[model samples]
Target: MVAIELKIGSFKAEYAGKMNLYLSLLDRFERGENENQSIGIILCADKDHLDVEIALQDINKPIGVAEYQLLLSKEELQTLVVNEIKASTKEEG
Candidate 1:
């Protein structure tokens, strides 16, 4: 299982704590006995790499933080998807 949290602004230290809580809950209640541990992904509109690094340094969970863009036009979005598909096909080949 993967838990995702989306934020509109920059990354905050508290976000990591929130995600940790989510992962814990999922592991306790939702995860199956044979399943692997839950993972977490935090997506923010902007983030500082150093801040994210520090925030997750001491944590043992499989969590990751990434930035997202909201300003892409429809054409740009389509192009990106197409390119990603092409890249993935090449890898599979």
Candidate 2:
């Protein structure tokens, strides 16, 4: 079984500690003796790549940090990006 954590806030080192605790608990109580090692994923709304790297440096278990996106239509996202670029350009000008 896999353990998944979803967070809408920034990723932090403290989250790794929590993941470790959860994995440990799953292994002890949830996983069967012959089951594959549990997998852990931390899906956050925002994450600093460098911070995530440093946070997972010493972690022995399998853990991954990834970002999630809202299910917006492609055109909507494109429009948002174009508007942002236009705003930025206008401000710069």
Candidate 3:
């Protein structure tokens, strides 16, 4: 099983905003220090790109928006991509 960090601040934030934040955090988390097989989000009232920056102004950690699930890890996705590329190359060749 995977882990998720859900952050909620307001209602307007919605799930879409949370997903975007998840992707952004995932990128950072992948390189930064942390356990694998876990995900996060950053919730807020609005997601104006700048809003997210401000909301995450001075905070950091395995955080998520709201209504969460155990999403796959970056390494897992990368491995899948590499495998797909290899398979495609082999098929073409």
Best by the lDDT measure: 1
> Residues 1-93, candidate 3, lDDT per residue (tens digit)?
123434434423344445545556556566445545344444343345654455444544444444333256768868988999999999999
| True lDDT of residue 12, candidate 2 | 84
Candidate 2 error regions (>4 Å): 72-93
How far residue 31's Cα lies from its native spot in candidate 2, in Å, is 1.0
Error of 3 at 62 (Å): 33
Across residues 39-68, which tens digit of lDDT does each residue of candidate 1 receive? 999999899999999999988899999999
| Cα RMSD (angstroms) for every candidate in the order listed | 7.7, 12.0, 13.0
**Model 2 Cα RMSD, Å?**
12.0
> Candidate 1: TM-score?
0.75
RMSD of 1: 7.7
Quote the lDDT for 83 in model 3: 97
Model 1 bad stretches (over 4 Å) = 72-93
Estimated TM-score for each candidate: 0.75, 0.73, 0.28
What ordering of candidates by TM-score runs from best to worst?
1, 2, 3
Error of 3 at 65 (Å): 15
Candidate 2 clashing pairs, residues 3+ apart or interchain: none
